[model samples]
Target: MVTQDELNEKGKAAVMDFDGDVVAEIAEECISAGLDPIDLIQNGFTAGINEVGTQFEQGSLFLPHIIAASEAMSAGVEVLTPVLENLSAQAEDKGTVAIGTIEGDIHTIGKDIVATMLKVAGFNVIDLGRDVPIADFVEVVKEKKPAIVGSSALMTTTMVLQLQVEEQLKEAGVRDTVKTMVGGAPVTQDWANRIGADIYAENASDAVVKCKAAFE
Candidate 1:
């Protein structure tokens, strides 16, 4: 019999190794063992990605490694999506969030990680996908009436579009109804302030924390 501790270790190792298959296997074992999938995700998979983030910050890991690890983490999450959905159905809705990469930015690894983290945190996430037009964002805000709208821009040039999103939201008369969050490699707290964004997430973990706090 595989103990929960051993399964946790395997989950961590699978992510660190960037082995999506192993991570999926661990998720299956978690279900079979009647272990809480949320615990494995929090303690095992998320812990592994957190370590990878730390290493990236410490200069021991590069962008490629971060991308790979994010992909691996996403795979594990994909396998557990059905179970997560069932669990979500049984719980009270936290809030709704509409997220996307701003126009002209094709990069998605960072944004994808943040979206996954938000889903794991119990928010109903509406992923707008990469290279989303500014108008589309405003439309979603108006239609979905989500609590938060998150925009990601990875380049200095593309980051300006996040400001446009905020402006459009205001123009559409929905700015006051939804909190706006901006994040990316080139985004800064000062930038967020300059654009009148409600939140600036430094990373995936920080995004989850700040988004949750926005309600409190």
Candidate 2:
């Protein structure tokens, strides 16, 4: 029998190499070995992405590398999603959240990671994709009406779009009804408070913790 640590290392390597097929392959192996899906996500895929994140911040990894790793992590998570849904039936859905990068910001790797972590943590995630307009967020809040809305912006220029989103959400009259979460490299807790955001996530793992706290 393969040890959990060994499986985790495989998962990590797959993401580091940006090999989506290998990531899925490791996920299948974990399933065959009866390992928990969440554990695999954390120890295997998330662990790898976390390293990729560090390397990215330190300049050892480039944007394309980060994107590839995120893609690999996403593929592994897709493989685990069904099994997680089954687990969710045994547990309870935390809440619904809509996530996206703000308008004019094409960066998405971090946002994608947060979405995956949220999903594994039992949240129903509605990903709005990258470079999403503020109006779309307001419209989604008016239409989909998720419990929370999250925005990501990688640049100081684009980060203000998160503030704009909050303003629009308030204008739409759903501000009081929904919680707004903000995150990205340029985002900070003070910034979140200044922007009237309900939550500020530092990373993918922290995002899951904060999302759970919002409901709890």
Candidate 3:
């Protein structure tokens, strides 16, 4: 029988190698072991992705490595989604968050990372996908009534769409009901302040930390 520590190390290694098959295998093992999917993700897969993000930032790894590791991590998460859903039914929600990229922003890597990390952190996440229309985000906010609304844009051109979401929320009379968080390559805390967003997370780790802090 494989020990949990060994499994954790394997998970980390699989992610660093960008081996989706290996990740899925480990996920299956975890499920069979009756492991908590959230713990598996947080302590195992996320640990690896965090390192990948660090290495990428330090230029030890490139964009392809980041993308591959993300893919592997996502595949592993897919294997555990049902377990996560089952656990969700028995636990109190941390928070409900709606996330999306702006209509003109096709880049979704950063947004996807945040979504997965949020899910692992026990947030009820409604992912609106990349290039989502502002109307759709507002509509979901009005309908789902999540505690936080998150928007991302990798480019300066589409970053303004985050403002549009805020405006739409205000126009729809739901702005007061939810917190707004925005992030991306061109996003800064000052920009978030100027845009009237409630929070500005620098990266996925910061996103989770800020999200937890918002409620705590």
Candidate 4:
């Protein structure tokens, strides 16, 4: 059996190589070896991406490298997600969150970071991706009934779409079903409150903590 450390190391190497297929192969091996999929994601994929994040923030790594690392981590998730989902059925959720970037905001970096951190923190993150339609957000909430809904915006012009989402949720009759969280580069805690968002996160870790607290 391959040790968890070895699998993580291989996954990390795959990220450094920026080879998606290689990352998937390594993740599959970890799964076949009976390692916990979440552990593989954490010790392997997320660990590598977190380093990418650090390097990116420090200006030691370029945007391309950060993109590559995210691609690699996403590839690993493709291989391991089914296994993790099976376990999730039996595991207690730290919380479930429906997350997306608002319409007209094509940015995903901030939302992706929050999703990754939430997953690492044991939350079931249903990421709706960038430029999501308002109906999609409401539909997902109706289906998943998550503990929280998170919307992110990068551009100031697109920030109002978050409010649109809130209104849509109200019209759909599930506005009170879940707490709302909003964040992005230009978003501040006061702005979140002003827009009726239940909370705001300056970064991914903060988002994860806020999500955990919302359910507690």
The most accurate candidate by TM-score is 2
Ranking by TM-score: 2, 1, 3, 4
Model 4 residue 135 CA deviation (Å) reads 7.5
Clashes of each: 0, 0, 0, 0
Between prediction 2 and prediction 3, which has the larger TM-score?
2
Best by lDDT: 2
Question: Which 10 consecutive positions of candidate 3 have the poorest summed lDDT?
Answer: 84-93
Pairs clashing within candidate 3: none
Kindly give the stretch of ten consecutive residues in candidate 4 with the minimal lDDT sum: 84-93
TM agreement with the true structure for every prediction: 0.73, 0.83, 0.71, 0.63
In model 3, how many backbone clashes occur?
0
Lowest lDDT block of 10, candidate 1: 84-93
Which lDDT values do the candidates have, in the order given? 0.86, 0.87, 0.85, 0.80
Instruction: For candidate 1, write residues 1-216 as lDDT tens digits.
Output: 888778888898899999998899889988888887766776788778778877887899987887787778778878877887777666556799999999998777678767866876788899999999999999999999999999999778999999899889999999999999999877999999999999999888799899989977
lDDT of prediction 2: 0.87
**Residue 94 Cα positional deviation in candidate 4, in Å, after optimal superposition:** 9.1
CA shift of 52, model 2, Å: 2.1
lDDT by residue for model 3 over 94-196, one digit each (tens)? 9899999889987676787688768767898999999999999889888999989899987789998888988989999999999999998779999999889
Stretches of candidate 3 off by over 4 Å are: 1-6, 54-62, 93-96, 104-124, 153-161, 171-173, 183-191, 200-216
Segments in model 2 whose C-alpha atoms lie over 4 Å from true places: 107-109, 116-122, 154-157
Candidate 3's C-alpha lDDT?
0.85
